[model samples]
Target: MQELLEEALATLVPSDAEQAAVAALCDSLLARARKAAPDGVEPLLVGSVAKGTWLPGADIDLFLRFPEGADLKTEGLALARAVLPDGEELYAQHPYLRGSVEGYSIDAVPCFAISDPTQPASAVDRTVFHTSWVHDNLTDAQRNDVRLAKRFLAVAGAYGAAAAVGGFSGYLVEVLVHRAGDFPAFVEKVASWRPPVALGAVPGAPEAEITLPDPVDPGRNVAAGVMRDGLARAVLAARQFLAESTADAFVVGAAERKPLGCVTTVVLPHPGGVEETALPHIQRQGRKLVRALEPFGVLGSHCSLGNEGFIVLETAVVELPERQLHRGPAVWDAGAFEFLAAYPQAPLRDGRFWALKPPRHLDIASAVQALLPKARVVEGLADGAEPLPAA
Candidate 1:
């Protein structure tokens, strides 16, 4: 295990030259930001880069901290734009500039300076506190463990906490690694986690599959974004890694998907917006479609968005009986009369009213098309659609 970890670290850790290049780039960007900012606005480095836990190609996060009353929307944007004139503006809680500088992607976010993480002035105000907490608490060995944990999660397809990925965030990884003492220990703990997992005693922390209270902000759950399937993937990956006991576990590979039924893929035009703002809606729409196709024996569904949106549904049966037995209200209930009045042919059996009615959709493709009027439903997997794993 030690040898495997060392080998993995050798490949994961940044070389001296790479470190020097990143340092130079950060210094130059910071200088440009500071020169562009007005009085009372302080520019500082943040994220994985600032904490020295960044991967080789990780994007640099440069935040411009404004004073109590500074206009972050206008003045902060102007300062960021002044530093990177060609940067594109992207929106989160507010607007930020995203652009490339000397081959490295950089995000120039403007946030209000705050002394308390719990009482953040803006959405990103807690980032500075997160960076400081990691820097102050994690030892050198633990930092390396964080790197390994990140690599493991990435390989397992559970590293990001974006709307699309719905996996572990970098900060969450750091906290878990620090608490577990090392990567192996962290894996052991994760492998045993049953969902609704709470890491600390945080009162009124939002209920989630996994809940880890933010150390800096007790009110916030760092793991709230983790999806149930993503958590399962991490748990399975950890168990597999422990069983294999090999360095090969760190390598990225496609997960083998065994379909439980006939697959149908639906392609739809992407609703125009940033992915972070648009993907949840897409997922929700896909889930609604899945529910609509339940009569056709839909086993599971997966949604992905890129140039277009793709929803894949796996169904045990592609076609359903034309006439389905629709259960109505109990025979003794007030609604039973209404049900009989509506159906006129509904029969009462075992104290309940049941009606044999022809369903609106008899096939998966038709059901998908009916549910999503604009969807292009394919009989099987679409050109770029991914299949869901077997249940």
Candidate 2:
């Protein structure tokens, strides 16, 4: 099952343009690093992208470990700007990693020293960043598991890989490791995942495609717009639930508190009940919000894209609902505004499904309410919305 799931998720790898951009960026960064440090060899690619387990629309991950005790900022930042050019516009500084270069954002992470290759990063964050092994080591299964784990999250809109890194979860890491069968089997133990509903797997008339009117790029079509909207609404619903539970306001609060920093969205699942008719609009707003939240923390989920729920990782589970609901990005229609307006706290179940546990912080109610308040409403099946009884 783990191997099967990994295979399915691997299908979502990035387009040729994205791959090229990343490769060019990496080569440039390496050039700059070698120039800056005469004694150093070139930097290496690490993380999901390096592992060849990255999902479609994932970021480029690179690792530059200067000889022990060397400062990475000088070499790393120089490489970053040289590749990206406009630091203010394209690059954004991250927590541990240097900064994300624009145009398929690339993460230039530094390598920390680790004594043992066997031990996990959880046990030794200060000594070594796990991404080192993610970039350097790992068997073929482990690499596949990384791709699978990322696709699961990317489709779920839990962690926008190119946008931020903090949203990455420990559970996801554990699940990937287990699935790879390198050590304990965590993914096999929690083997349920939601599959994404195919939106435009086939193309018809271009005029009919329901994508968002690209504000920045008018040439952009609408089927992708509809998909983005659906994903945005789904993500918003998850964020709202998290805010209610954690009391950690998203963009608004984060902006006021930390002007220089960005806001992070926790990945939680939503129950299916209401219609998701505003996927286009939701996607547009969601993308805009993502830009705003970039300085804080780019947050999202790892469930499949649409309806088939194989496994889900609900993070920040304190004070969470007992049961959680989930839906694919395609399941969200323009009609979601109707029920979501009436039932702020109710589950919107159409083609939607449920996860084994209630998502804690990824609730989209509050965010949706803020974004789509006119559509807010109290729902009927609000009391006990459990996962549809197992097949």
lDDT tens digits, residue span 1-391, model 2? 4444434644555678877877777677677655654355246665556556665566665554545545545655555445445533222222123345555666555443444443332222221334544445566667655555444433333333222221234223433464347422423222321223232333332542232222212343222322333334334534443344221211111212112222122221333321122222333444544443332244332222123111111222213355544442223666455545444454434664222444433443343344434423222112222211101
RMSD to the true structure for each prediction, in A, is: 2.8, 21.6
The TM-scores, one per candidate, come to 0.89, 0.37
lDDT for each residue of candidate 1 in 58-152, tens digit (9 for 90 to 100): 89999999987778889999999987789998888768999998888999999889888888455588899999999999998988888889988
lDDT for every model?
0.85, 0.39
Query: What are the runs in model 1 whose C-alpha is more than 4 Å off?
Result: 258-260, 324-357, 383-391
Q: lDDT score of model 2? A: 0.39
Report the number of the highest-lDDT candidate. 1
Backbone clashes for every candidate come to 0, 77
Total colliding residue pairs, candidate 1:
0
Q: Give lDDT: candidate 2, residue 160.
A: 37
Q: After superposition, how far is residue 17 of candidate 1 from its true place, in Å?
A: 2.2
Q: Candidate 1: lDDT over CA atoms?
A: 0.85
